[model samples]
Target chain A: MSEILERIWEYRQISRVELVELTGLTSGTITNLTHDLIQLGILRENEAISGNVGRRRVMLGFDPRFYRIIGLDIGRTSFEIIVMDLNGTILQSIEREMNGVQGPEAYFQVITPTLTTVKQEIEAAGEKILGLGVGIPGPIHYESGSLLAPPNFPGWKGYPLKQMLEQQFDLVTLIEDDARTSAMAERWYGLGKSVQNLVSITMGTGIGGGVVTNGKIVRGTNGLCGQVGHMTIVLDGKMCDCGNRGCWETVGSIPGILSRWSQGSTLMELQTAIRQGEPEALRCIDETLAYLEAALVNVQNLYDPELILLGGRLFPLLAEHLDQLKPRLQSRLYAFAKDRLRIEPATFGTSQSAVGAAALMLGFLLSEPVRLLSLQDS
Target chain B: MSEILERIWEYRQISRVELVELTGLTSGTITNLTHDLIQLGILRENEAISGNVGRRRVMLGFDPRFYRIIGLDIGRTSFEIIVMDLNGTILQSIEREMNGVQGPEAYFQVITPTLTTVKQEIEAAGEKILGLGVGIPGPIHYESGSLLAPPNFPGWKGYPLKQMLEQQFDLVTLIEDDARTSAMAERWYGLGKSVQNLVSITMGTGIGGGVVTNGKIVRGTNGLCGQVGHMTIVLDGKMCDCGNRGCWETVGSIPGILSRWSQGSTLMELQTAIRQGEPEALRCIDETLAYLEAALVNVQNLYDPELILLGGRLFPLLAEHLDQLKPRLQSRLYAFAKDRLRIEPATFGTSQSAVGAAALMLGFLLSEPVRLLSLQDS
Candidate 1:
């Protein structure tokens, strides 16, 4: 049944005959499964507008109006709440900025009212709320869905965010690291669909990474496998917030680059200066690029991923320099890895983490529809 | 049948009752499978050495006399061949040193005769040769089992080593990178038996790493993952043979360390000097440890394996300093990973790679007994 749903999701609108062919299910089994799915409001049938006029076959697709997901992205500086459909279409989104220092209580005070408003709107529209997925900016204890010491946001350490959200909203909830959530977004809805092994590097104010191997996120023993930012690039280099010296984050992060450019130069001003080929700006960008290149080479060597998806605020600024990066990496890579590893900009701008949080819920729903049904029944 | 064999391999010897209890297979099924396995000379039944005075149940165990594997380890400086049983016992072993510049043909000249002598001995003892497992030092095209461009050994580039051995010996042969093969040996017979995720770092003439995740080797796209030696530790510090600057291998490897010390000083002399607390030797050792610590921290951050098995020649030299490495790594690691990761020396001494190579074939047989049966039938 999940396979049938996955086929429909892939094709968007596939006929019953095509489903039978693609899934290798008997026509009777397909009919029975489709009927059950339609009853659950998980799938809908529409009349196909075919070129041939013999008969208009019924095509199956997701019933977007029946259920919606609440995706919350709690970033370092701000938090966002978005209502998303199964098709990843955003129904509503709201962003609220906070000072760098805020405790869990203050965060909940802002989040509870916003969540209630979204829940009410969802109920008023006659759409069932599937779940809430929160994307936080640090390591998470996957089983408990609690935050592990997030840098700068020390107040949220060990907070039972998943349990709190589940109890307050009375919905199924999942908490994942923001980088991993972004990876999920890319895997399901963006360029990652074509590849099984991918690494998503999110470079914003701080650097974070998500590793995907064999089409699933690699959550290591403590769910801290993709902490590429802390990887050392320089011997006895700059001290980082993590208490490490010469972390990739020290040189490759947005703030790190800006700080090196000038004391108060904006990213735009630096970009302008780089475009004009100013020596100091070029020198700063070159240093950052060198560090980025080394880190990228290290990533390629360590993971040997087929595709590396670059996302977050810093990637767009570096996208233009990627051509230069390729040749440099090719020289540094293992012989077999040369020319095979691809570096590309990730799809989805600004709302990547929010959509990814929604994707986390959607992925769970698609893979285990019975769980969703059980939750609804309960 | 594989499950039963694996259980027997685990316990060394087990009664039908124990097998049934352990595997959840019915008594009748266990009896039938054991009977068939005995007929095929894969298992042998023996009178139980029982402490309890009841009906003395018979025990089943592997028939070590029936089959053996030819394990060949081809390294940059030398080559070793070993005859290993299903229990990983070294029945026979041989080693030969080579000039570093020896090509594939020259090395094969030495290996073929030694392999033939071992095969003759096994046949004389009425044992069947199961297969050949070769551990080569370089990136390999996994499917074809051919060498990729190995550093310093340019003549071995693109050598079809596996096919050549298969054609020469007329035995089912498997080729794998040396570090990965060492990991296989660890996973099956060493400390890695307790942990599903492991990384084996072989630091000898050069540095290489093998990653095991979820009890399986992570052979990334092109089968070129776990190249940790090439990961940059210093930004533009030293030029490596791989054309990369500041590679971990350039500093952490045996030659890398020796070169940093007095050029004429042997590793033994340096070890002696460090023991005497000479200032220059202490500085060199400290520098080496610092690089090693940084690389290890990077490894822990990247792979996050529960156990990191340190192998190769250089490890024993630095084993005493591991006490110092722990606090340094703890201070550098992400909060969750601190104190959770275990660093231990690998079990196998000089014969590590050879035993690992044989274990590769043993692993294949244990997982897929049908493939071995078909080979015998053919």
Candidate 2:
């Protein structure tokens, strides 16, 4: 039932024949399933448009007033929260700069105001909140509900995100790596909807990626997958905090870009120069994409996501340079990957992580749990 | 009907209550469904086993006499054939070496003799063959039904794989990369049955990987997934024929080991020395593992499959050194992955690819036709 409903939601709206064609389900099965779904308050009969005089067949769609999931984007400097309805509709969202974060406790200390406002807004609108999802920039012990320290975020180690979210509301909570959440946002509501496999490359002060395989996030063993920034894309390039050298992040991070700017000029100067089509600045960013290409090739050689999305605050600049950058990537990858790979700029921009976190909560509710007797003992 | 039968086969045997409990379906639903499944001739009620003596119950099992799939393991110098029943039970299998594979016509010459022998063997056993599946060592153009220029098997590029098979038998024919096929085989009858996401790493003449993400094989846009061998692991360590320097295969493949050994001594001499506990030869293999460690880190950071299966003809040596090698991987990867990641040897040994190809064919027939359109197109 949920699978059929999901197909409808994914397609936004679907005709009866198309549903059978897409899902490979019998027409009778589709009819029976959709009937039950509509009666359950999950779906509605979407009215036909008044375009041409033809057989006016009504389409099926999710009711916009259905359950909503909360999306949380927790970063070192700030946080953003969003409420997304089940039909991919946004209800209420808030973004704010963080308070003084000293230790892991302060991580929760700051979100109190944002959380209160979001819940109040939803309740005022007379809607039931399904769940809260928090996206953090770190390696989470998916089993233990603990966050490990990520090099990019200095003081966010060991944050009890799941407990705090669950305590705040009588709802199931899910926590995901911020970059993965960003990737998910791209996949669920952005350009990734059409792709079965995609790599969402998030380039901020640090570099990260999320793997979408068969239209699902490729969470690795222990739930730490798609950390492409940490891969050794450059050989002996620079010393990275992750105890490795030539990491893509080491060569192509915000700090690395700023430092290079400082060596001769400044980012502002480079920005101004690039605005006027400066050859040197274009060369530098193009070179950065070369490392980006290597990391992406390593990613391609592994899972082979059909699309590659470039996200983060740097996207505006990255977009301008992509026209120049893509050709380099084309020449570097294998013949098969080069021919099939599609590169696109991120659609959600800075808010992807927040939106993706909410999707995780919804996904958690829909997922079937696995039982590990030994793990339960532990 | 088949889904319920699959559940019965998976559990080996289960009571009505157990089925209800496992499936979370209502008792009435289970009873009705079981009756329908039983009527379908896909399931059977075998003799009962009384665990509690007085509380003996009928044991339901998959009907072993339903149908079968034929699998072919197309290798560089040999071929392995396997006949698997619909319920993933291998009825008969055989392996034979090709004396001479001169050119692209090798498939026509070598395959004829092997198929004739395999047909007689299965006919003698009185079984119904459903389809034929073949696992190629390199890329195959599923649409063209021709082999790609595989690096290892130089003589068999563009061979008409599907047309020849279809001529001899009235059976479904499926084709796949050997690693991908081997990964599917594990998903059906081996270690991957319990895991949703997995990476099967085959370390032999070359290092290859098969990605199982979201409980399905991740065939890339061009069906060239799991090409971990081509990924560069070291910085200019050794040149690869694919025009890349220091590919994972360059440092971790058997030919790579031989190349490194040739610089000091022959691989035979090194193996003999290892048997005699010679320090220098031991150090060389240890260095090879170090290079492998880099590739392992590369694999982990990219997708993070739950379990990493080490397979192929030469993986027995890897098993002996896993205890030592696993620690290096642990120390390098993120804390959560280090504990959650499992490394195991291939269960099917030398015949995994053959078994996997057969499994692919069987799964296609058992599943809804629409899902396997790409497979059917070949």
Candidate 3:
């Protein structure tokens, strides 16, 4: 039954016959499940427009207006909160900058008001609120739903973010790594819709990564599987905030790139310098590109992902130079791996992580429909 | 039904009551399934020892003597073949030196005669050969069952090894990466039996690794997920045979270690030197340990495996120094990850990959029982 709902969600509007073929479920089983879902108000049926002058078939899809999910993305420098429908369309959104907000107490002061406003907006719309989903930087203790030594946010380490959110809002809350949340967003509504094996790279002030294999996130034993930023690029070269030296982020991140480009204070400035063909900027970009090429090759060899989605603030600036990186990557990759590997820019812009956070809740709801059903009953 | 068989295989012997509790299958279903399995000669029933003051319960277990598996492990300098029963007990074994053997035709000359003898012996013993399992040295194009530009064996690239074996033996053939095969062997009858998330690293003339996540092998898009050996440890530090510079194997592999040691030409000699407290050997070992420490940290950060099983010829020599390596690893790992990360030596000795190859066929047969049943029918 959940599979049926998932297929409907994926297709937007799927027919009973198509569901039967796709799921390999019996026609009778599909009809019964769809009927129950429709009766429960989770799905709705619509008549398909016919051009053949024959019987029009009915399509089944999610009743997108029925439920809403609150998504929050907490970065080192900023936070964004949003309310979204089942189709992942943002209904309301609010963004704020964090000027060195240090601890949980300071974070709550800024977060509480924004969440309250969004919650009221969602409630006033005559829609149900399913849950709260959060995307936080760094590795998380999945069992405890807490942060684990997030770089540059030492005060946030070990904070029970999920518990705090649930207690404040009295709603079910799910916390995930920000990069993984972005990958989830891609899996649902972006380039990852059809790809099962993929790695989403967040190239920003710091480099981070998320992996999806066999259609599920690769959350390792401690939920630390996607720390691609810390992968060593130059042995004993540069000290990183993570206590490791020569981490890939030390050479490929925005700050890392800006450090080498004497004329740029920001990625935008670096882009401008490169556009003007400044020798210093070109040299810096080339050095960064070489490291990026090596890291991408390592990603291919280690994860063998079918597609690598590049996101975050810095990716677009480097988008034009991707052609230069590809041939280098192809030459280094295994022969069988070279032809199938794909590198592409991500779909969403600034809202990628926030929408992905909402997707975290929506994805859970789709997989375990009974939870939503119980919430509705309550 | 496959789940029931897997549980029985894991437990070695169990009663229907335990099967019901373990598998969550109804008592009636357990009885029917076990009865059918026994009837097919896939399982056998035995009376339990009467330690209690009650009637003895009948236990069900595999009829090991009825079936057999052939395992082959191919390396750059050597190859090994073994025949085993369902219980993983080696019945016959053969080992030979490759002596710079290259290309498919040359390999067939040596492999064919040995396989023919093994096949005749199994036939004479009235044992059914289930399949032929081959464990090759490098990444394979899984879909096509061929090697893809394996380093040092350029002539063997693109060879249809699986098809060639299947045609010659008239038996089911399975091919897997050598490291992964070693992991499979562990998963079935060794330390990995109790571990769900584990990585097995083969530190030999060349380094290799295999990952098992969520209790199954992580075969990425092209069956190249666990190329831990090629992960860069130093940027432009040393040239690697795989066309990469500063790969972990360039520092941590046996040859890589020997290149830095002036007094030793072989690993055994190096081990002897280190044991004798020679300063040069100690320095070389320390250097190798630092690189290994970095590589292991990277593996932990990227894969976050619960346990890392270290195998191959060189690991045992370094086993005594693991105490020295652990503290360094602990300091660099994430706090939540530190306590849970276990580094241990592999269970099998020299025949790890060969036995692992046999277990591959056994694993496939267990998952798809119908295939074995169909073969029985034929």
RMSD of each: 3.3, 5.4, 2.3
Q: List TM-scores for all candidates, in order.
A: 0.91, 0.84, 0.95
Q: Which of the two, 2 or 3, has more DockQ?
A: 3
Question: What clash pairs does model 1 have?
Answer: none
lDDT of 2 by residue, A125-236 (tens): 8776666788888678777566876776766677676776667764567788888887778777788777777888888778888878777787766566788888776554
Ranking by TM-score: 3, 1, 2
Q: How many Å off is the CA of A237 in candidate 1?
A: 1.9
List, in the given order, the native-contact fraction of each candidate: 0.72, 0.43, 0.65
Compute the lDDT of residue A159 as modeled in candidate 3. Answer: 95
Model 1 chain A: worst 10 consecutive residues (lDDT sum): A259-268
- Write model 3 residue lDDT over B64-135, tens digit each, in one string: 877888999988778999998877788888999987788778888998999999998898988788888899
TM-score of chain A of each: 0.93, 0.86, 0.94
Predicted candidate 1 versus true structure: per-residue lDDT over B223-295, tens digit per residue: 7688889899988878887767899999989888988887246788888888988888888889999999899
lDDT of 1 by residue, A73-141 (tens): 998778889998877788899999876648889888888898899999889988898888889987888
| Every candidate's lDDT | 0.85, 0.73, 0.85
Backbone clash numbers for all candidates listed:
0, 3, 0
